[model samples]
Target chain A: MASSSEPSALPTLLVFRVRELRFLAALRERYRVLDFFTSGSPLAAFLAAAAGGADPPRALVTVGGDSVRVDAALLDAVPSLRFVHSTGAGLDHIDLGECARRGVGVASSGTVYSTDVADHAVGLLVDVLRRVSAADRFVRRGLWPLHGDYPLGSKLGGKRVGIIGLGNIGTLIAKRLAAFGCVICYSSRKPKESVSYWYFPSVHDLASESDVLVVACALTRETRHIVNKDVLAALGKDGVVVNIGRGPNIDEAELVAALKEGRIAGASLDVFDKEPKVPAELFSMDNVVLTHHVAVFTTESRSDLRDVTISNLEAFFAGRPLLNPVLHS
Target chain B: MASSSEPSALPTLLVFRVRELRFLAALRERYRVLDFFTSGSPLAAFLAAAAGGADPPRALVTVGGDSVRVDAALLDAVPSLRFVHSTGAGLDHIDLGECARRGVGVASSGTVYSTDVADHAVGLLVDVLRRVSAADRFVRRGLWPLHGDYPLGSKLGGKRVGIIGLGNIGTLIAKRLAAFGCVICYSSRKPKESVSYWYFPSVHDLASESDVLVVACALTRETRHIVNKDVLAALGKDGVVVNIGRGPNIDEAELVAALKEGRIAGASLDVFDKEPKVPAELFSMDNVVLTHHVAVFTTESRSDLRDVTISNLEAFFAGRPLLNPVLHS
Candidate 1:
C-alpha cells in the first residue's frame, strides 16, 4: 500500500513501453510523465525510476516483453508506485503474487489485442488453406506454364476447424470462419455457454477430429507444451496447425519433427519461445510459415492499447477502481 | 441448332481445351467410356465422335481455356448435340448469342467459381495491406533494414474498401471482408436489395472515397476500362487497388502509368489484359504484387465445379432445364 505521501506533489507516470513514439507523446499530453523506457533496459530503467527524486510516478505502465524477478525487486522499492498496467493482453509479465501481497492494483490491455490477433490468425488460415503464398511464389518465380497449369488449391469451406480457446480472439475467429460455411468446434478450459459449436473436452480430441487446429488460448502453467508431438500425430498427415497463442504452448521441437516427418501437413506460427531468434530450421521448410510475435501489432490495436493503459493510469491516480483490473489471486 | 439426326447416331463427346489434365480425367469419369482427344486437334476429335455409330455422348464439354471457334464449328455439324457445358465461370469463349440463335442451351460453371475468387481477393487484400509478399521477398533476399527497421504493414480495420461488383464472387468477397472489420461499400450496375452496404453511384465516386479500390466486377463493354487513370488518381497516394476481375476492366496501360508515377500506394493483380504477359514494369516495382489468373483454381472449388458440370451434363442428357443456363438477350 502507498504511504500517506504529501498531497501537494503532482503524480508522475512511468511510461515503460509503447508500439510507437506517438503513443508516448499522447500519454505525456494527459499526465505528468516522468521517465519513459522499454523492457530492453529492464534493470537500468527500474533502478533509475526507483531512485528518482521526490515526485516519482505513482504508477508504472509496462509494455513490450515480459519482466521477471529482477523487475519485481525494483517494483517493490518504489513505495510511491501503487499500480501497474500492462499494454498487452497477457498478464504473464508482472509478479502478480508480490503485487497482491503489497496491496498494489494491476490492469491489462485485454480485449484491445483481440481484433489484431484475430486478423493475423485469419490471414494465416487463408494463406495455408488457399496456398496463396506458395502459388504466388511459384508464379512470381516464373514457374507458371505459358498456358496456366498447377495443382488445384484447397478451400476453407466445409473444412473442420478446431479452435483451442474460446476467448475474445477465438470467438471472433469462430464468427469469421462461420461466414465461410466452416464447421467450427472449440476446446477451451471450460466450454463457452450459448454457442452451437461442438465442444471437445481435450486438446488431443480436438486435434484428432479437426482438419485444422488453431491455438488462441493464453499461456499458463497447465498449457505448457499443450500441443506436443502426440497432438501433432493425432492431427494426422492432412491436418494443419496454427499457433497464435504463446510459443511454449506448442512444443517447438515436436512441431519441427512433425512437419519434417509429414505427421502434420503444415503449420503457421506467430509466436516463438525465443522470439526474433526463431529456429533457423523452421525457416528452411516450405510447409511452415513464420512470423515474429507480432500477431497483436496493428495500427488500430496499438492506439487502443495506449488508450487502455492511459485510462488505467488515470483511474489509479484518481483513486477510482481500475478498468480491466488483473486480479493477482 | 444441331441438325436432325437420331440420338443413337450421334458421335462420342469431344473434350477440348482442358487446361488441367487432372480436371479432365475427373470429369471424364461421368462421360461414356470412349476415345478422347484434347485441344490439340478439335477437328480430328469431332470427326471421331461423329463416326461412332453407337454410345454417342450427344453433347460436347469444353474445359480450360476459351473454346476456339474451330471447335464450335466442328461440333455444330453434330445433329444430335443437345447442349454445350463450359466448365468455366466466364462465357466469353462459347458465343452465347450464337448458341441461343442455334437453339442450343449453354450452361457454365457459375457460383462454383466464388470460393476460389473470394479466396484470391482476400489474398490480394492481405498481400497489399500487410505487404506480406514484399516483406517475404525482402526476408528471402536478405534485404532487411532497407529503411533500417521492420517493414511497415497497414491495418485492415477502419479502412474504407470499395468493391466494384456485387455478383457471386463480389458478394463472397464482401462476406470475408466483413470479418476484417472494414467499412464496406460497393458499386454495381444495379443495387442489390439483400445487402445494406453503402453504394456509390459511380466508379469515380467509389475510387475517391475508398482507401482500397477492388475490382471484382465482370468484363463487358460497360465495365471495360472503368478503373482507368482517373479512378486510379482519385485513389490517391495512400490508397491500394486490387483486381480479381478480368484484366480489361482496368486500363492496364493507364494503371502502369499511375503505379509508375506513384498516384496510388500499391496494387495486387491476379489477371492482366494479356495474361501470362504481365508488364515487365510491374515485376520490377516493390509496390505491386502479381499472380497468374488462378483465383478460381482451388481444390475445393475445382471439385465443386466438376460436380456441377457433371450434373449439368446429366440434366442435359435427361432433357431437363440446365441449372446455370447462359443466354443472350
Candidate 2:
C-alpha cells in the first residue's frame, strides 16, 4: 500500500498481471505495483477502491498476447488514468481511437523487437523454401533410412519475393534476402521513396510476379485479409507464403483451401486467425510449417521490451515525452 | 552403342546410372550415353566392351550424393578416361589425387550451389535459435492450445557467429548474417586475405567465442571430426552449432553426448556421420534440428549443376579447358 502521508512515496502502477518475475521486480523498484488480476479481489471492488483513494494510480501497464481488452467502459472506471503502456509492438488489442478521444497517451515497445521479428520471418521463409521443418519431421520419424531421398525443395536465390508491407520489419527482411541473391519487391500503402525495391500498387499484382509472398503488415480494416483468395490465386501453384504479421492480415480459410488443393505451393505461418487453435488440416501437410505466435518472444527481445516499457512509464510519471509514443491519426 | 564407322560421331559418356531423366535427355543430345547399371551388364564385361571399342568413352559424368566411389581401381579400368565431372561441389567420392596423377581433368559444380547452401545454413541457424522446428512439432502435437504458451527462444542479432571454413559457402553465409547484425568470425585452414572478418587458427578458440558455430568445410582426413569433444566443451552451455558441410565434420557421438547432457544449448545438423542413419538419441531431443543432407538439393541448383556438368563434358570432348577445374595439391 502506498502511503498518502509520505510525500516521498512512489506512485502506484496498476497491472492486470505480471508474467516475468524480473520485469515485476524492476517495476517494483520504481513504483508500488498493484496486480488486479492476481490479487484475487473482485474487479468491481478493486476499481471502486482505486477510484476512492486520495492518490489513485495514474498509469496502467500490461503485457501483450493475452487478448486483454481495454475498452471505453473500463477506461470510465479508472478516471485518474492518463497513460497506458503495452510491453509489445502490436497495438491490435488496444483501442487506439478510444484512447485518443479520451486524451490518454499510449506507448508500445517500438522497433525493439523488429530485428527479432524480421529474423523469424526470414527463418520461416527459408524453412518453407528449403523444407527445414518438414525434413526435421521426416528425420525424426525415422523415415530417412526407410525412404531413400527426401523430396527436393525450391531454392531461395533468384526467386522473386514480394513483401506485403515495407515497414521496419519488412525492410530488414528485404535487406537480408538480397544478400542471398533474391529479387525483392513490395506492395505497401504507397511507395517508400528511400528504397529502390520495385513496388506494386496492389498485392494481387505483387503476388502474380512473386515466387514467395511474405505478409508483415499491421492489422487494420484496410489491411485485414489483404492476402485473400485473389492474391493466393495470383501467387499460383509454385508460390510460397510466409506470415509473421497478425493472423487476420491473411484469410486463414482461403489459405487452408489453397494449400489443400495445391493452388499455392506452401505456407509458413507464425500467427493464426485464432492462435493456439490452428486448422487441423495444416497438421498433416508436409509443405506447411506452423508455429505459435512467437515472432517477438525471444529472451533478448523480452529484456529490451521490459526496459522500453519501464522507461515509457517512468517518462509518463515524470512529465517527460514517451520513448515510443503511438501517435493517433 | 557408338558406331566406330563414323569418324565425326559424338564421343561416348559412361555413367553408372541416369537418375534424372532431364539430365539424361540433355546429355544424350551431345554424346553417346552409356549407362552400365541400367543396361544390366556385368561390371567386367561392360568395362571390357567400353575399353575394347575403337571410339572408347573419353569422359565420365555422375550425379552427386550417391557415394558412387571413383577410386583407383575404377580409374584403372577406364584407361581411356580423359575427364571426370561431378554434378556437385563435393569431391570426396572422387579420388582427386589419383585423377591428378593420371592426368585426368576433374570438374565440379563450383559456386552454382553456394547461394542455396548458404541459405539452408542460415535457415537452420535461425530455426535452432528461434525454435522454429521445435515449435512446429509442438503445434502439430496439439500442445499450443493445451500448454498455453510455448517457451521463448534466443535472438540471432548481436550474437557472435563462428564459421569453421571461410570457403565460397561460408563467405556467403557471413555476408547474409551480417545483414542481420550478427558479429561474424571464422576458423579455416588459413586466414583469407581479401575479407576483414576476424580469424582464429584453432576450432577450440573459435567455439569459445562463438554463440553459434557453422561447419562448412570439405571432408578430409585432417578435417574429419574437427568439432570434437574439446571444441564442444569450449562452446559451453549457450552455444549452438549448424553443420551444412559433409558428414563427420563434427564427432557424432560426442555431439550427441553433449546435447543430451545439456553441455551445449542446441544444434541444427543437415549432415551426419552416416547418410540416412541419424542417431536415434537425436530424434527425441527438442534442442536439435535434423535434415536428410539436403543443403544443396534444390530444384534450381540441380538445373545449374546439370548445365555445369554438361559444359565440362563438352569442353573435355572438344579439347577445350574445363570450366571449373579442381586443382590437386
Candidate 3:
C-alpha cells in the first residue's frame, strides 16, 4: 500500500492483529503505520520483512486476552522491537519473561479498565444474590399476576466475599462491595501489605469461609483452574461466584457441574472457557448470568483504553517512562 | 377462632391482610391473635364485632402496601385500638393523622428492610446501567457464539446519580454508589440538614442534572406521580431511572412512552404503577428491567420484619415505647 503523505520521515510504528479504526487513525497521524492485519501477508512473513527493512519498527501494538502471542520467536523475528503495548489489561498472552530477557519494555491497559471491571463484578454479584436478572425474566414472561410473587432474593449486606486476585480490579471490587456492607477477604499470591482485609493462603481456604467468590485474577500457569471442584464445594450450597477475569481462571466444567447439582447457589460469568462458545448447559439455567466477555468493554472504558494506548505508544517513542508499565514476574 | 389455650385472659392482637405463616406462628406464641382474613366476616363487620366484644383488642398488626387501609372508617369501628404495627417499611396505607387524632401509636417495619431495599436499589441500578439482564438474556438465547460481542454496558463510575427520597433506604443507596465514584445528588420535599449530598428542591431540577434517578421515597399524596413526564424528559436520552420505592412514584404511562420513544436510556423497576399488572409494553423491551414488587421481601428481611413487629407489639402491651415508631406530621 502507498500513502499520500511523506512515508519515511515519521518514526516507524508496527501494529499487530488488533484493528480498532479510531485508535488506528490516531496512531497514523503521528507515525508511518505498519498494520500487520492489513498488510495482505502472514504476521510472521510481515514481521520478518519489517525487521530486515532499512527503517525497522522499534515499537509495536498488540492485543492481550490470549488473542496474540508475543513470544521469543516473534521477538526474534523483529530484532529492532524495543517496546510492546497491549490494549488489554491482562498480559497473559504476551511472554513477559521473553520480553524481559531481551530488555524490552511493556505497557498494559493499566487502571483504565479497573473501574469498569469492578463495577461489573459488583453488578454481577448483586444480580446473582438479589436475583435481579431472574426477577426481570419473571416479569417479562408475565408471570407476576399469575404466580402472585416471584421467589424472594437473598439479602446482600452481610455476605462474606472472597476475592481471588486482589490486584487493581480486585481492590476496586473490594472497595465497592465494602460500601454495600459486605465482608471482604482475599487469596492473592501473597497478602498485600496495603490492604487491611483478612487474607487466606489458598483458594480452597478462602472459599471455605466465603459466601461469594469473585474471581478477578490474571490468567497464568498457577492461577488456571484456581476455582475447581474443591473450592466450589467449600463455598457450599448458598455460595455465589462472580468472574470478571479470563475464562480459564476457573474450571468451567466443574463450575457447570457445581451449579447443576445445586452445590453452589449461583454464578455470574462474563468470560467463558471458549470465546463466543458458552456452555450449552448454561443457556438453560437461571441460577447463572452469562455475558459474552464484556466486563470491561463499556463505551466509556473503550474511549479511555484508546487514549491510554495512544499515550503509551507516544510515551515509548519519546523515550519517556511508559504510562502504564507491566511488571514481569 | 376457639383455641386450646386460654383465650379470654390474653391481650387481643388483631391482624390485617398480610399472612406470613412463620410470622403468624411466632406471633401466636405471644398474643391472642385475631386475623381479619380468617375471621369469616367482612373487614368492617369484623372490626364492629371485635370493637363490641367483651375482650377488645388494644393492638393490631397490619401490612403497608396499600393492600389494607387502616383509615378513619376502620379506626372509628375499632375505638379500643391503641397501637398498629405495620409489617411493611412503607406506611402510606395507614392514616397517620387519624391514628394521631385518636392517640393511636404507629410502629412501622422501620430500618429492618432499609438495607435490603437499598441493596436491591443498587442492584437494579447496576443491572440497568450495565445491561446485566440483557446480556444474560443474550447468552441464554444461544446468541453469543452467533452474535459475537453483545452490546456494551455503560459505566457506573462518575455518573451523577440523583436520589428521589434520600430517606433511610435512599441514604444507604447513596452510600453504596458513592464508593463506585458516583456523584450523589438528591430531590426531596425539603433539603436535609444532615445530608452533605447536593440537594435539588424538585424532581425536574434533579433530573436535569442527573444521569441516574433512584426513586426511594414513600408513596404519599404529595409524592405520588412525583416523577412525571417533564421530570423524565429532563432526565434526557441517556438517563437511567431506578424505582425501589413505590410504582406510582413514577407516572407509568409517561414512563412507558418515554422508554418507547427513547427519551430515556433504560429503567430498572421493582415496583410498577399497577404492580402485578405491569405495562405489557415493558415485557418486550430489553432496555427496561421489571420485577414484580419484591424488593424488600428477601428471606433475611422477612425474618427481621417478623422479629421487629413482634417486639413492637410486646413493647406496646408492656406499656413501653414502640420499637419502630412513625412520626405523624
Candidate 4:
C-alpha cells in the first residue's frame, strides 16, 4: 500500500509503537497513518528508507512505556522529526533532554490516566491492608468453613499514609484515601505549597511516620531506587508499601528481602524492575499483592489517551501550543 | 480461675460470644464477668441455672455477631435483664422489638465500626471494578510474560456507584468513593435530607442507573434479598456489586446465577447468605472476591469496641445514658 502518487492534505503521523489497533482508525481519519508495525521492516532499514525518502515523517506518535528508546541516535536518523506525541503518561522511554536539544515539541498523555492510576494505587493499598486477595484464594480453595474465619485485617482509619510523589496521581490518591479517614503526608523533592498535607524532606522520615507508603513518582536518575533498604527498614514491620509508580522507583530486591524477613508488613506492586517478570519469591507471599504493570491501562483511559494523542498532533500541525508539552525548560 | 465468693461492690455482667480473649480481661476489670461459655453447660441449662441463682444477671454484653441467639426465650429466663449491650453493629441477631417491649435498654458498637466497614466496602468496590485480586493471581501464576498484558480493567472514575441503605456505614462508603470521582447515589426506605447525593426509591432503579452497586444495609425481613434477580438484572452486564453489609442483603442464589450467566461484571463479597459456608459455585469464579465476613473485625476496632462496651456498662451501673443506644423509641 506504499504506492501513493497523490500528496494528500493530511499531515503524516509516523506511529512508532501502538498495539491498540482501534485507536489507529480514529488517527487515520485525520493523519496519513504510517504505522511502523504494519511496515514489517527491520528497525535500521525502515529508518534508513524513511530518512532517504523524499517526504520523511515530520511528526511522530508512540504508545505505551515500552522498550522503544527515542534517543539522540534515533533523532539523528529522523532529522525532520520536529514533534512527538508520547501518548503515555511516562516519558522515561523518551529522552527528554535529547528531544529538547533537537528543538522537538514533546507532548504526553497529560493527566488523562491519573484518576485510573490513583484509583488503582488505593485499590492495591486496601488489598494489602485488608488481605482481600489472600482471603479470596482461601475461600476458592474451600478453606472458610474448614478453617473457620480468616485472619483479622488492619483498619485504614487514622493510619498515616505517606505518598512518595505528590504529583497529579499522588495527589488524587491522597484525596481518595483522606475520605477513608487516613492521615495524609507526602515526600517530594520540594513541598507542594497548594496542599496542606504534611511534607517529609526525606523518604526515610516519611516511611518512619507512615503505616502505608505509596510510590507515585516518575522514574528518573535521582528518583530511581528511592525506596531502598533503609527506607523499607524505617517503614517498620507494621508498615505496608504500595507502588503504582515505575518499577525501578523502589529497589525490588530490597523489597523482596524485606517481605521475606517480615521487616515490612506487606506491599502491593503493579510495576516490577523487570516488568512482566515479577520476582518468583512474591508468588507465595500472602502479604504482598502483585499485578502486571497496568495502573494506567484501562478501556476508559484508552479513549482519553487517544484524544490526548490526536489533539496534540492536531495542535502541532495547526501552529498552536501543545496540549501536554513536556521539557518545561 | 473460679474463686470463692467474695462480696465485691461491682455489679455482675453476663458475657456471651467473645472469642477475642484479650477483650475479656478488660471487661473483668469493670464488673464480675460471668462468661456463659465457661459454664460448660448447654445454653438452656446455663440460662436455667443463672435464673435459679439468688443474684440473677441483670446486664449482658456480647461481641462478634455470632450464632448466640439473644431472643425472647433467653430474655424471659433472665427477667431481671434491664440493660442489654450488643457490642456489634448489626442488631438483626437480637429481636429489637421484643427488647423494646421488655423495657431493655440496648446499646451497640455505635459509629466505632462505621469507618472500618466503609473502608472495606470501598476496598471491595475497587477490587471488583479493577480486578486487583485476579490480576495478582495471574502475576503470581507467572502468566504475564507468557500471555502478554493481562486484560484491561474498567476505570473507577466517572463510575455511577449506587449505595443501598444510607446509614452510617453506607454514608461513609459514599463519602470515600465520592472522592475517587465516582457519582454517588443511594436507595433506602426514604430519602435522607442531610446528604445531597441523589436518592433512588427502589433498589432496581438504583441498579438501573449504577455502574457499581454496594450493599451496605442491615439484614431484616424487608431488606433481606433486596438485591434479588430483578435488581441484579437491572445492574446490567458492565455492572459490579460489593457487599460489606449482611450476606442475605443480596440473594446468594440470584447473585450466583447472574455471575454464572455474565449478567453482572463482578462481585466482591465479605458476607454470604450462609456465612462460614459460602456458595461452592462461587469458589471457581475469578470475577468474585470472597472473604469470611471480617469487614468490621480489626485489632483497632476491638480496642474501640472494648472501650465502648466498658463505657456502656459503667454508664448503666452509674445510672447514666447508654453510649450507643439502639432500638430507638
If you superpose only chain B onto the true chain B, what TM-score does each candidate give?
Answer: 0.85, 0.93, 0.94, 0.95
Question: What are the runs in model 4 whose C-alpha is more than 4 Å off?
Answer: A1-11, A29-42, A327-329, B1-11, B30-32, B38-40, B64-66, B327-329
Off by over 4 Å in 1: A1-10, A17-19, A29-49, A66-71, A77-79, A145-149, B1-11, B26-58, B64-82, B135-148, B284-287
Candidate 1: TM-score of chain A is 0.88
Better DockQ candidate (1, 2): 2
TM score of chain A per candidate:
0.88, 0.93, 0.93, 0.95
For candidate 4, write residues A143-259 as lDDT tens digits. Answer: 877856566789998899999999999999999998988999999999999999999999999999999999999999989999999999999999999999999999999999999
Writing each residue's lDDT as its tens digit, candidate 2 over B43-116 gives 77777778777778888876555645777888888898878887766888888888889888888888988988
- What interface Cα RMSD is found for model 1? 2.5
TM-score of model number 4: 0.94
Candidate 3 wrong stretches, greater than 4 Å: A1-12, A16-19, A32-56, A327-329, B1-9, B37-56, B327-329
- C-alpha lDDT of all candidate models, in order: 0.74, 0.87, 0.86, 0.85
* Model 4 lDDT, residue B303, Cα: 89
**Model 2, range A1-329, lDDT digits (tens) per residue?**
23323453889777767677898889878886777766567877776666677678888887555645666876788878888898756788788888899888898888998989999999999999999999998898888989656789898878999999999999999999998889999999899999999999999999999999999898888999999999999999999999999889999999999999999999999999987689999999999999888898899988888889888988899889999998421
lDDT for each residue of candidate 1 in A136-223, tens digit (9 for 90 to 100): 6766767665654466666788889999988889998898888777899999888788798999999999999999999999887888
Residue-level lDDT tens digits of model 1 in B49-148: 4545455456767754334542356445564555777786665566566666667677788788887788778878876777656655554453332323
